[model samples]
Target: MPWILAPRRHRVAAGVAAVLLAACTSVPLPPERPAPVEEVRPTVPHPPAANAVERARSRWVPVDWTELPGWNDDRIAEVWPALRASCGRPAPGWAEVCARAMLEPPADDGTARAWLARWLQPWRVEAPDGQVDGLATGYFEPLVEAVRQPRGEFRVPLYGPPAPGTMAKPGWTRQQFDTLPAAKAALRGREIAWVADPLDALLLQVQGSGRLALTEADGSRRLVRLAFAGHNEQPYKSVGRWLVERGELTLDTASWPAIRAWARRNPQRVQEMLWANPRVVFFREEPLPDPSIGPRGAQGVPLVPGRSIAVDAGSIPYGTPVWLDTTEPLSATPLRRLVVAQDTGSAIVGAVRADYFWGWGADAEAQAGRMKQPLRLWALWPRGARPQ
Candidate 1:
């Protein structure tokens, strides 16, 4: 497979103010608590102070570069791919910056850093309650085993959406995966691939995309990536929170590993847990060009392992350069870096909300599944663009 050069057109909407609608829905959210501090990042190394906190509106507060922790140390050049990808479809107020960036690549790390400082301004987003810190999580492309068709150990089917008008409604609930005749009939001949573990199927759907190792009849294996296509258009419910609410698991013990362990122990209750989230995501298979690059995010660009982030589309438009200030999943070590808002998720909402894109494999999964940390974001907008 070859690395694809695809253009991502970011459709911009009104700024972070629109995310208030999330409160009306049942999106799974972490408890509100002050962020645990294990690392205190140094502020701008050479700060003469060029920015300040402006008035607050719907939780977005304009702050100067001096306030962005670790802003001066970020390897802005490393995220060029992420920047270039969004340049293909630069959003409102971003065309000039994206255009300048595409005209020539940065000369060096220092030059890249200079370019960002010269052309962009940073704005710190806060929550509605005037809190600068908010929840953050991690998402990644899962690696799993699958077959071209149903085989000995592969019985579960991962499907694409039924043809237009084939579905009984615009969307199908989780129960429709097996119950609804239209839903079952619609996917009869549309199996993307047959994965061995039902748990893998559940996670792929939740994560919205992944890569699969396909075993041919002769035993040769090849890796193919699954990208999000469409969904059953149903609302999402969190099984973890459901378990917590039902007294089946405590909030402290609701990590993915724990959930899977419980699933194994109570196989009979697995279906009940699986269907707790009525949202059923569909996928489209694509070529996996390189092991290093991740799948294209909602911004329509390939994600850069540790430098890409998924954010609430309402809170932060795709293609916006963000000075991410957060901690590593468990260690609380500073994970500060420059990341692009290239993706979005159902569970991702609010002004300062983000979901860090952590590449793939067991290590990535472990990090992603355990991540739920305090987050603060600084959107680096083009200096010459309209105020965000």
Candidate 2:
């Protein structure tokens, strides 16, 4: 009994000491941590800038010449005979010559090429010096100097129809011919005169009197009266090229007829196609002549009297008023007037928009239909020198 009591206290103390030693040896500390890294971003690229000339060139689109309704094979064939006859005897290399002449007629002197190079800046193709086997290959020259010095002249609008003295042919009509009531109504209360003709009966008068006085080096003075008729609504070169580049037409295939034909085939696309072109031209006092012959052919839009004028708009500031005068359609009478060049059009390039004086009758209609020609232009600006 005495031995059991002494051992109990000693056993309890031994057990407690053993437990404390085991707890101290069991646990361990965590290792030191590392720092985080940041993510890197990639760079982006930009498009290159366009140069001035490139920018200018970009404005033009190619036209589908064959799509034009006027370009019938029969019509082309018919015109070829007249062209050949006018060109005289065909040389061995005549085809190219004929093509060039048809595409771009030569000046009266037969020394200058009529096709002006848009990129060349005032230089146009003159007659080529060397022959491609005796015929001229073609040449280039400055347009401002090579052509006859441009005399300062303005174009005037013609209204209604041809006056009594201007009738040159007999009146003719066709089944498809129908006058627009809007046009006929617009003619009322407008200040204009009328004329009669054997062909398309009525005529409109826009310009009354203006003259061109050309002075020769020999001191001789020649006064020529400017007469003009109808309006123009076509684009020049640059805008045409732009249309081609934009997939509207192919270069080889994009002639006036091709485009016109395409338009006829897809009448719904006409407005879209035209709007995409962005280079349409409108004339106030002059008319575009039809390339076709005969009385029954389609005529272009007649000029809206007084309120319209032709404009490039890109070059000339919009809303500027201009004075125009040109020779009368099919006649030598001078037409002149003041017009507001307030609009831009696809075909209205180089400051040459003719405002027509819309008159009455078939002769006027025919005259309006038959009025279009290459013309010189002058632009007037306030506090700035007039531009040519």
Candidate 3:
């Protein structure tokens, strides 16, 4: 999905002493309630004539592109049964489990409460005053604040600090994170809760605070703060210049001050702009060599683009090949294709299903958002190996 950077909000003037005091006093809180869980119903499409278990043990090989579309649908359908059989039903209290799972380890019940307070303090909830319970208040506000703070210090960047801007290089787009092995691995085996759907496996990655010193292939380094989903997933050329071309603003519009002014004058428009441009991203305090590594060495596997899958890496090694088949919107032809499991994510933690990051920028984000369909999957592993 596209990662859009939300325009920074304007800040009120504050004395340096006050700023220092605030920094010293503010402590982060963990989320209180666990993430909500919804029920997922299994849907079995027509079964594949061949046994999927047998297919999974074969060597990686390419299938005809034309036949792939049909195969993908069949694969998704067949794999769901296997996934259900392995993972079993979602726990009776799975929501709490999922929510608590998102927290860093070493968390206890009391720590979880404090963390919720720190995380939820910044959110603007619209529920009634009485309905605004302690849990909601504690969880969202702190999380939002954590997102606003700097990567290391957990302090928000000051407006007048005049930080230096980093230069961008050619051929490196923001969407490259989707293809990174580390990011994929981090997402594996984790269940994601969606706003609208209980069983939606696609998780939205939002903005987080942190600075990174990224080393390019050429060994050059550049420092940048994480703004994961801040900007609309549109290409800089499309959204950035589009703003200029449409007379919404100029290339040299007043930096943060001017942008904040515009946002104040057009709050709804600003919200629309932000909602339209969301991108998926991963960020943490210290720059991780690979964002994909999870709590342990477990790897997140990416489903093939334009296909659906159910995966259990304990049973299937990374880099295994798979085939997927599905139908498309209003098209008579089935969408079928071959893919290599190259990435993974938290929302992809199903024994029967997986997600495919469409890869960088606006066009990719647009495609990823619209992908909801039934599928059939077939795995290709080594011969004579038992399924993990």
Q: Write the per-residue lDDT of candidate 1 for residues 302-365, one digit (tens) a residue.
A: 6677777777677777788888887886786998988888776555556677777776788877
In candidate 2, stretches whose alpha carbon ends up further than 4 angstroms from where it belongs are 1-307, 353-364, 384-388
Kindly report the root-mean-square deviation of model 3 from the true structure over all alpha carbons: 21.9
lDDT of 2 by residue, 1-388 (tens): 0000000000000000001101112111100000001111112311232311111111211222222222222112212222322223222233345445456543432222112111112211111221101000000000011101223331121233323333223311111011444333433333121112101010111111112233444556443222222221122122223346667666444432344455567667654443432211111221113211111000111122322243444433333333344444456554433333332322233323332322222333333323332232222222212122
Best-to-worst order by lDDT is 1, 3, 2
The true-versus-predicted C-alpha distance at residue 132 of model 3, in Å, is: 42
Name the runs in model 3 displaced over 4 angstroms. 1-204, 207-316, 328-333
C-alpha lDDT of residue 354 in model 3: 31
TM-score of each candidate? Answer: 0.81, 0.23, 0.32
- Model 3, position 307, has a per-residue lDDT of 24
In candidate 3, what are the lDDT values of residues 85-158, reduced to their tens digit?
11122222222322432333223434533432232211111111111111000000001112222234332221
Better of 1 and 2 by TM-score: 1
Is 1 or 2 the stronger prediction by lDDT? 1
The lDDT for every candidate, in the order shown, is: 0.66, 0.24, 0.27
**TM-score, prediction 3:** 0.32
How well does model 2 score by local distance difference test?
Answer: 0.24
Provide C-alpha RMSD values for all models, in order: 9.2, 40.7, 21.9
